[model samples]
Target: MHYSLPLALALGLLLVACQSAPSDTSTSAEAMADATPGAAYQLVWSDEFDGEHLDTTKWNYNVGGHGWGNNELQFYTDARPENARLAGGTLRITAIHEPWEGKEFTSARLTTKGKADWTYGRFEIRAKLPSGVGTWPAIWLLYTDKEYGNQGWPDNGEIDIMEEVGYDPDVIHSTIHDKAFNHSIGTQVGDTLRIPTARSAFHVYRTDWTPDSIISYIDDQRYFAFGNTGEGWEEWPFDHDHHLLLNVAVGGNWGGQQGVDTTAFPTAMEVDYVRVYQQK
Candidate 1:
C-alpha cells in the first residue's frame, strides 16, 4: 500500500524521533586506535554484526506492515536474508522504493527480541547513517511486555536512543514516551545532538538507563536526561525491561517530502556494533 505523502512524512519523523560526524583528518583504523575507551562496565550482550550474514540466532525480524504504530509503508519481513545482512564488520538494512507483497516499500526491521532484554544498563551502537531526502534510520528500544498492564502505548513506555532524519542531517534525537506525553501529539521530553558528518562516518549513540534516570549520550557526550518522577506510569514507564530495534525506512509519513530519490536506491544504514553493559 502506498502511504499518503503527509502520513509518510509524519511517520518518517516519528519513527526516527524514537531515536554524526566525520573528520577526514584520520582513517578509520587510526581513529579506532585513538578512540577513548568507553567507561568500564561489565559486558552483558553484544553483536558485532560481523561475518557475511546476519546471525539469526540473535535477532528476529518484525516483518510486514503491522502499521508500525506510525502508518509506516514498508512490510517488515523475518528471515528474509535480503532485509538483513552482515558485511564488512557492519550490519546493513536497506530501504528500497519498490513493490513487495502488496506494499510499495520494502525494508527490514531487526530486533533483539527473545534473545536479550535489559532493565537498567548502558547501551551503545556505532553506526553510519544512509543519506537521501526520503531515508529514515533509527536505533531505539521498546518494552518487551505485550502491554503495559492495559495502560497501552506510551503508557507502556518507549525509549529512542537515536533517531535521525535525512533532511536534518546534523541533528540526532533521543526521547522517551509515556502516557502523559507522546511524540504523536508532540509532547515528549528529548534532546538533539549535532553531528557534522553523521552520514559519512561512524559515531556512537548511547544511553545509560538506571533506576533513577535515563541519560542519552552521543560519543560519550551526554545531551539528554529524564528522571523518574513520583507520578508513576504517566510520567515514567521505563522501570521494566526492553529490547533493541534497528531499521531503515523510506518514504513514510516523514520521509517522502522531496519524494523518493530513486537514484539513491539501495541506501544503507550501517551499524558497526551494538553492545550492552551492566553495572557490576
Candidate 2:
C-alpha cells in the first residue's frame, strides 16, 4: 500500500458523527461461500487465541523502530506481553505511551509472512478496536513474493481490509493498492463507513477475494469492491500470495494528524479470532 505516503486518508480527516449504541454486526467464517461465486469455500487456517501465549507456529513478530515506511512512532518488539498477548480467547495488541528501548511508545505488529501466506481466498477477523485520537489500527495484507525486490510495494499489491483511526472512532476504512491505482497517484480504490459500534463492540472485518474481484465487508455488509480490470499485473497484482499484518500505530502521517491524546495510553485492539477460508 506504500501507506508510508498519505495518498488519501478519509478516516483521519473525518470527525465522529451520528452517535449510536453499539450492536452486533458479525459475519461467520462459513457464511461467505454461499454468496461467493467460486469453488465452495472451505476452512483452511486460523488462530483463535485460546491459549495463554501467542502460537509461534502460525505467526511471527515484526520487531523494530525503523518507521516501516510509514513514519510510525511505536517500537515494535518481539515476544513482549505488554505489546502483544493472548488470553481469554483473544489476541490483544496493546499500544501504550512509555519509554522503552529508547522509544516514546511501544506496540506490536504481528504477521503471517512465511507461515501462512495465501493467494485468493476469503479472510475474516473479529476485533474490537482501540479508541482516542492518534491510534491507527489496521488489518491488512502485504505481498509476500520476493521477485520485485525493495521497490515491490504498490506494484506487488496491498489489501487493507480494515483500518480505524482513534480520533475518528466511528469510521472504518477498506482499500486496495496497485500500480494503476494508489494513494501516491491519487487513484487508489477504497471506501469507508461510519459505524457507532466500531470501537466499542466486536465486528467482523473481511475480504472476499477471488480471480474476478476483491470485496470488503463489515458485519456481513459489503462496502468496498475492486473488480479485476483485465488489464495486467500492474493493476491486478493480487494473483500472488500475500501475508497478513495486524498492528496499531501511533502518531505518524494520518494517525497523528489531529494530535494524540496523551491520556489514551495503554489502549488496545482486541482480536477475538482470525480465520481464513479458501475455495476448494
Candidate 3:
C-alpha cells in the first residue's frame, strides 16, 4: 500500500512480523506509539507503568541524602517501594515525613538516562501532581553529555516540561535553562499555567522539541516556547540527545520559598505513563 510517510511503511512491516513471531516489548511498544492523537509522530520509547513493579529496563533510581543541589529536605532513596513503586497501572514517587539518612523526608527520583535517550522528539507524560506547602514535583529533561553536572548546569541544558510548587496550587511551570539564560542570573525563560484541578486530576504535560524550537503544553494547550538562537550551545544546548527525569523534591529553594508545611509529607507524584515520539 502507498503511504504518505516513511514511518508508516516501517511500522506496517513490523506489525506484520509481530503477528507471526512471538511478541516482544520492542515491537509491541512501537506499534502503539503512533496510536495516540498528534501529528503522526512515531513512538521511539515509552513506559505505560503497566506492571507490579517499576520497570527496571526503562528506569534507574537516583538515590542520595545530599541536598541534590537544591537543599531539598528529602533524602532520595532507591527501590524502597514506599518511595517509588508501580501498582494498579501507575508509578508513584512518594515523599514521606519519616526521616532517612539525616534528612527529615524521604522520596524518589527516577531517570531514563542511559536506557532511553532521544535526540529530539515529542515527549509527554500523564500525571497527577502532589500539592501541599513545600512539595516540588517536576517532569524534566537534560542533555546526555559527560560534562553535564561537572561543568555546571545550564551549560549542559535543562528542559523543564512541567514543575509545580505545592503552595501555589494549579500554577504549573515550564522552563528552559542554558548558559546564556538561566535562573542563577535571573534571565531564565519560563511561564505558568493555572489549571484548577491539577492536584487532584490527571493531565498530559508535553514538550515538542525539534532542531529549531522547544514548545511546551498542558493538555495540548501551548504555554511556553524557546527557539534556537544559532549562537552556540550556551544559548541552545538542546541541539543534542537528552534523557528524562521525574522527581518530587521537598523543601527546596523554590518549594521552600514559603517554608515546609511539615504536615505536607506523604504526598507524591503519580505518573500514569510516559511516551516519546519522533518523526522518522
Candidate 4:
C-alpha cells in the first residue's frame, strides 16, 4: 500500500511499462453476482471503474499533509492518474515509498467527498486487499465537518467499517470510536472476523448503517454491530451524514510494525466496485 523512494521509482517505471499492456475489458452488471454466488441486493450507485482512467466525477483524492488521526506517510492527490487508475475493470490505488512534498510515500486516497454523502444506508465494496508487511487498507466513513465538541478525535466519532493490516491476512476489524473509546488507549470496542482468503480473493465488505445501529458484514455474514444508546457523543456522533474513504496506507505507526517489504513495492488495493443501497 505504501512504499519508499527507490520502490516508488521502480513502481512508476513499472506502471509506465504496464500502461501499454493489454488487459481484460469485459464487464457486465453481473460481476458481483458471479463473485458472490446468490447474494440478493439492489444497486443504487455503482462504479466498476471500467474505463482506462479514473472517473473524476465519482471520486476525488485527498491530497497533501499527514492525516490528523494517524501519522501516515502518504499524500493523497487529486486527478492524478498515477495515484489511481482503471485497469481490467478494477480501480487500482497503489502505494509507493517515494518522496513527494517531503513525505516518503505517495499513494492514492480516493473518496466520494463532494459527490456522495449518506446518513444511513447499506454500503458495499468488492475488493482484494494489498498484501505484504506495512500495508494498511481501510474502508471507513467520516463526518462532513470538523466540529468535535470540547475534545477533538473521538468526540466527533469515527466508524471504521473495515480495517485490515497486511501482517494479519486472515483477520478483519470493525470498530466505532467516540469520546469514551478509541484504538489509541486500547479502550476501543469492536469485533474481528477471520477471513483466510481475504487477500487472495475479492470479497464484499459491507456496512448497514441505520438510525438505531450500525452493522458490519463480510461477504453475507454479519460480524459486528454498534447501537445508538441515546446517551451522548460517547455513544453516537453518527447521526449526521458522512462520506466514504477508501485508501491503502503504508508505514504508519500501526502499519509499519514489522517494517516494509521491498519486494511488495507497488502493492495495490483493487476495488472491483462500490455500491450504495437505500431502503425502498
Candidate 5:
C-alpha cells in the first residue's frame, strides 16, 4: 500500500527477482579485488566538471516534471543550460525533445543532496551513455535526510551506482533498495553488466561503500554485491549519510518499457568525473 517517495522510487525500478543466486560474478570479482581501497582510499570528494559552469558549490538542481516517480518524461530543469552543462571537461546530462512546463522532454537532475554527504565511501563516476531507445541513465545513492520509513524511499536506502537502458544497450545496472529488499517485494538486491563499449566509451562507474558491504563496479569489474544483513533497517540500510544522483531519464517505468525513441532526441549523459573516496 504505502508508496510515495516518488512512488517508492517508481516502484524501485522493478527487475522482478525472487532472489538468492549471486556469488560467482567471478566470485564477486574476487571479493571485490580483496576489499578495494588500496592505499586506504582518500580523495574525499570531487567533481572535475572542470569549470565552465555547473559547480553550484557541487550541484543540487533536482527541479521537476512530476513523473520522477518514473512515469517519467523529463522536465527537470533549473534555469536550463540545454538541460545542464559544462563542456569539454564533461557533465552533460542533456535529454531534450522540446516543450517544457507541459513536458515533452528536457533533462538534468544533478544532486548531492546538501552538497556532498557520505558515510562509507568510494563512489566514482566517469561516464558516457545515452543511446537510442528512451534513455534512462543514472548513478545513484540516497538517504541524505529522511532518515527512514514512509518517504525515505524504500525505507532509508538505495544505491544503484549506475543504471542504463537506452533499450538495454550495454546492460549495466547495480542495485540495492531496502525496506526488506525492494523492487516492491520481489526481494531485490541487484547486479548486471554487459559493457561492450557501454554506449560508445568512457567507463568507471563504481561504488564500494563499506561498513559491511555494497560493492558494484564496471571498470574495476566487481559485478555487484549487497551484504550487511544483521537483520535490521529492513535488510540493512547502509547506515547514515548518503547523497549523489545525476540523471537523464525520459520515458519511465523502466525507461518507457520499450517505447519512446523520438529520434533519441538530443540525448546525453556524459559526466567525465565525480569521485569521492574515504577510509583515510
Candidate 6:
C-alpha cells in the first residue's frame, strides 16, 4: 500500500522466528463456516482459487502502468491470462520482463474493491512469495471510497497486510499509513518479520482490525499492533471501508532501489487463498 516512496523509514524491529499455524485447506463455504467453532471471528468472505478461471464476480482487474504513485516499472494488464490466471487450484500473478505499452514489464493487479469491502475483520492470505531482486509482491488493502480528505491517499488510509521486496527475501512487512502517520513524513506504523520459507513455502499473513486497533500476524504470531489514540481522523481513518488487493511489481522506487535483475523475468507470487472473517 506504499503509493509513494518515503524519504525515510521507521520500520519495526521486533523480528521473530516463523512458526506454523494450522491451516484449513477447505474450499467450501460450509466447511469454513464450521472450521472456527467458538471463535470470536467467523468466516464471511473468501476466494479459494478452486476454480479453473479467475472469478470475475469476486475480483476486478486494475490496469495501468502509471507507476501507481510509486514509480513502479510494471504495466498492470486487465484480463490478460499471461499476467493473471488460475491453475492447479491457485491464483498466479506473474510479473514478466516484456515490452508493453512502452513499458519494459507487465503484470496483473486484482482487487476486491466493489466486490468486497470491510470495516473491521480478520483478513488472512495464504501464499508463497516470489524472489530475486526487482520483484515486489504485495497483499494489501486500500480505502474503498474517498470520503475523508481531498487527497485520497494519505488522507484516507491504507493497510499493508503483507509486502516483500525480492532483494530483501523472506522479510515480510505490514504497515498502516494515514495523514499523521505516513512514510512521506517517516512516521508510518509498521513491522517486519522474517519467515525463512516465505519464498519457498506457503505461509499465512494476517491482519486483525477492530474499532480500537489494528494488529498484524505471521503464521499466527502477533508482531505489530497500533492502538487507536482518541486522536483525529488524521491518525486513524481506518474506521471506514477498505478493500483487498494483490499484485506483483517488476521494479520501482522501493522495489528497484538496488536496481532490477532482468534475469529474474517471469517471476510470480502464487496465492492459495484469501479469506475474510468478521466478529460474529
* Candidate number achieving the greatest lDDT relative to the actual structure: 6
Q: For residues 1-280, what per-residue lDDT tens digits would candidate 1 score against the true structure? A: 1122243344455444334111221232233323323435799999998788788788888877755655566777666666677878898888776788888777898888788988888899999998877777889888886456555566677888988767666578777777655545544556678899888999999988776667788888777766665456666678887889998877666565556676776778889999999877
Give per-model TM-scores: 0.82, 0.88, 0.84, 0.80, 0.33, 0.88
Candidates arranged by lDDT, highest first = 6, 2, 3, 5, 1, 4
- For model 2, where is the 10-residue window of minimal lDDT? 16-25
lDDT of 6 by residue, 1-280 (tens): 5753421333421111111101211122123333333359889999999978899999999999999988999999999999999999999999999999989999999999999999989999999998789899999999997878865988889999999888788988887788877756545557678899999999999988877667788888767666665466887788899999999987788888788998988988999999999998
Query: Worst 10-residue stretch by lDDT in candidate 6?
Result: 16-25
C-alpha lDDT values of all predictions: 0.72, 0.79, 0.77, 0.70, 0.77, 0.81
Which runs in model 5 stand beyond 4 Å of their true positions?
1-41, 44-88, 93-120, 124-133, 140-159, 162-174, 177-185, 189-208, 213-227, 230-253, 261-264, 270-272
Residue runs of model 4 more than 4 Å from their true location after superposition: 1-42, 146-152, 184-186
- The residue pairs in collision within model 4 are 3-97, 4-97, 5-97, 63-76
Rank the candidate models, highest TM-score first. 6, 2, 3, 1, 4, 5
RMSD of 5: 16.1
The local distance difference test score of model 1 is 0.72
Error of 3 at 252 (Å): 1.0
Model 4 TM: 0.80
lDDT of 4 by residue, 161-207 (tens): 77887766657877666665554443454667889988889999998
For all candidates, the clash counts are 19, 1, 0, 4, 0, 0
Q: Model 2: per-residue lDDT, tens digit, 37-75?
A: 445888899989997999989999999987778777889
Q: Candidate 3 at 238: error in angstroms?
A: 0.6
